[model samples]
Target: MGYPQVSAREQIIPSRVPTDAKANALEIGPERTVIEITHVGVTAEGRAVKVTIAVAPVHYLTAGYELRSPDTRRSQTDDHASR
Candidate 1:
């Protein structure tokens, strides 16, 4: 048997920055907040299987000050992964 053909599509939903004073002070900025992925497999029957994935950002920690220190810079994986 051989592997079936597959097609995939991914979309990054746009984000809107909050206008409220408290929200803005919290450093909540415009970021790609949502991602949607769709996969489709094809076979002799025409359409074989379909799958979809929706991803969102999860804030493990919310601090009043920045987490990264000036002495040591850290990768912004948390922000980028959501996109």
Candidate 2:
């Protein structure tokens, strides 16, 4: 078989936030989110691949929030779809 093609990979290339951007803390509000582009590697001889090898801001459940929930229902508690 032949190799796959490098399709268009869309990304949000925002300006790097400074240290004092949010008083030295990345505050992910209820409607806010954060992500990190972990690595960009080439595979199978120049097949470009971008890997976001990181998790969200709230990786751990400090408060009464759950780290992993199977609740697929949509509610006002924690809406996955922002809009």
Q: Number of the top candidate by lDDT?
A: 2
Measured over all alpha carbons after superposition, the RMSD of each candidate to the real structure, in angstroms, is 16.8, 15.3
How do the residues 1-83 of candidate 1 rate in per-residue lDDT, one tens digit apiece?
56565533334343333335434545544442332234455655565455564333324222253354544433466556768
- Supply the TM-score for candidate 1: 0.27
Clashes of each: 0, 0
Relative to the true structure, how large is the alpha-carbon lDDT of every model? 0.43, 0.44
| Model 2 lDDT tens row, 1-83 | 45554432335433233334442365544444444334445555667665554334433223243443446443645675675
lDDT for 24 (candidate 1):
50
Overlapping backbone residue pairs in candidate 2 total 0
The C-alpha stretches of model 2 lying farther than 4 A from their native spots are: 1-29, 48-50, 58-83
Q: Residue 33 error for model 2, in Å?
A: 3.2
